[model samples]
Target: MSLSPSTFETIVPSRYITFTFPNHHHHHHHHLRVAVLDSPSAATAAASTAAIWVPPGRESDWIFSTFSGHLQLLLTQPLSRLILIGNSPSSPQPISYNSSLHPSSPTPLQRNLAPLLSALTPKSAFLDDGEIPEVPLLVFEDEVVKSSIVEICEGPCVGEMLIENVELENDGVKEFRRRLRFKRMPNFVQSQMRICPKNVTSFENLDNMKFELDRGVLVQPYLNPMVAGISVISRFLEGRTFRPKALCLGVGGGALLGFLRVQLNFEVVGVEEDEVVLEVAKRYFGLEDDELIHLFAEDGIEYVQNLAKNLSEECRFDAIMVDLDSSDVSVGACAPPTEFVRKSVLLAVRAILHEEGVVVTNTIPSSKLLYERLICEFREVFEELYEIDAGNGENFVLIATKSKVRNALEANEGAFLNKLKSVVSGSYIDSIRKIPRTADPAF
Candidate 1:
């Protein structure tokens, strides 16, 4: 029963749901979207689990830094319904009885939250043993999710449920207010906030990493994968007769933002949705709100979508480097990576890409299913694709380019290598050299 690829259709229906903390005046787009094809899909699960904080508290820091402690799934992976169990008006309304994700329904997903209390309750001494647990806030079709201020921790991410002790507060409302607390090491905090070079011990490198306000820019080695992705892009551009225009997504620490502007001299634009993040970048990362590097506080997906729909051809880039981190180096791939690397986003990338241009993304290949899906989706959009392994294969840099150099198309291997050498030199030179100039498909 072999079926033709063109004739085949997806049997598994997919669901795309978005969640976020309530919006503020300056940051209105505070939403995170997750797409789930089915349970057990690594990429889908990763994206859904990307951002759940235990609320920031001084007491929560000890548990987060512990070697190993309690762990639990924040939300159901392949999330069908988002339940906020609370009396608050801002909470999402419960899902109707007929909806597929309803826990009371006779569906496989109904079993997801059967033991909700036990699953969310982490074994920690901070909790009161006699305190009865009640559903304070549940925002979903099935039930209400209790609302709690999650503290961002800094340490290991065991993926285990280790909640700090819960203190049930009597808000004098009809139902008891459940102030839940959970914690995990903030995954990309250091990568985004700190500027460290490869050789941190050397005094000269340390000095180079320092940033003073309104002066020279700062960068971090945490962006090694992006560095590699950009190098591959530069090599491709150098083989051609045209210059490179670069775009960077996620201005968390402005590592790539600084590198592209100062080192490579590419006309660069950095897009970040978080004003708080952008403010931090300006204050700490030596990033200035200036004309040379255009900074936009908007969602990357919607930004690119609008750029393609509204903007003219002249606004496109020769090189686009996206660092909306798709994986936790310690845990594996997550949903944001899935969102960023999906067919739609990749196609949007292709829409704005120069016929001779390239786009690169940061990912972790440690997760087999996520890694394979990434390569597969990338190939669906670009003419040629390449990857560079970083941190001894911990991080994977995906380079997808619609354009190919004349030498490469003509099978002139030696000339192609020479051109790559010329485009990249210094610290970046060694990393790009580690990856073969050709794809594994070339075999």
Candidate 2:
């Protein structure tokens, strides 16, 4: 039953559906043309997925296989509309396929796409019309292609690496070993990755990881809010502007570091525990440790402790950003590992910070108790504490300051917006608008 690759025809019966939805300003309409293929084969899926849109550039192959499976399912059942959204709106939408309905039958997709788009499109005036729409298309003839399920990256990757580890529980030590892949899917212009566990055999296990866009673009929504938190520090140092120094504890891909050094005119010190990650960052993510940016391969907590013990005016940082997250899934809180947030560590961090310095950390609290506990722990050391809700509900950026930033949010709101205007470009400014209007719950 062996079949030649050439025996399969790549062409599938594809139906093109064209619809118009009002643009964000409602001044014009955006014509969305989706090609619906009937019963796409593996070759067609791969070709279509690669050609139409990429869910995550690094995991492009896996997404294609998964997409192929769903398309196969469409042969038997009526599935919802498949909407593959790219990170940016201007990025092309992936092709959708529907086989259950006749071409003349007006499916739910045609009926509801407009209303759904209107509701999901962000109301923010600053966001480009290209930003990812926040809604979903209705059910189509067969199969549901989830919206916003994958991370987008700028690509045409040149190199890739697969790091594998095996788990064997022994000697009172257990390793949660799986697969870790480092894909240098670079635009030569930009960078990103695709990682997943070796144990991930099905769609269920694949839930743990996704593709990531590297330093060139802040593909992660939370990163924008994280950058916005720095505006509080910038506003605090206004008029007395000296070259600000920033310390980044967990420099994953060095995206924040690149942003700080190249975009914001700041000297950055990045400390990453994983040497492999550091190398990947340099080789794949465009992280370079030049005069303006210094990279350290060491323990973040110990580094802070050493900085505290050898405290010097020259070593003090204007802003300290802790972006640590635990690899151990069993650990409830994902950011800062429990040790980084300890009172002693916080004190050491404060010791190495300039008087007007600010500390920002990305925290994903697994429980209500942990979240309240973190807020309480931070309030004890810093005179001012604020939270930038990333809107995802689970992720938050905690901004803590040494000096009492009286009404920091209200006082610096305008300044923060103005600062964003100066620092970020149009394509990325949507992140600024992503900042919750009611951010900085505490004054």
User: Candidates' TM-scores?
Assistant: 0.50, 0.51
Which sections of candidate 1 miss by over 4 Å?
Answer: 1-187, 190-222, 233-243, 326-336, 406-443
The model with the greatest TM-score is: 2
lDDT of 1 by residue, 241-356 (tens): 54467788777657667766765666788897666556555644567667678899888877888887876777788878777754332232332455676677777878888777
Candidate 2 structure lDDT: 0.53
Candidate 1 — worst ten consecutive residues by lDDT sum? 93-102
lDDT scores for all predictions? 0.44, 0.53
Per-residue accuracy of model 2 over 1-443 as CA lDDT, tens digit each? 43333322233333222233333432354433222333322322322221122232212232222333233323323322233321223323222222222233443334445544333222331136555433334332211222122232322222333322222234644322222232331111122222223434543222343333333345444666677777666566565546789999987667789888876778999997767667767755567989999999888999999989998898999889888765432232256578887999999999999888889888877566777778777877887776676775557788888886554555334543576656543432333222222343321
Top lDDT model: 2
What lDDT score is found at residue 375 in candidate 2?
78
Worst ten in a row by lDDT for model 2: 140-149
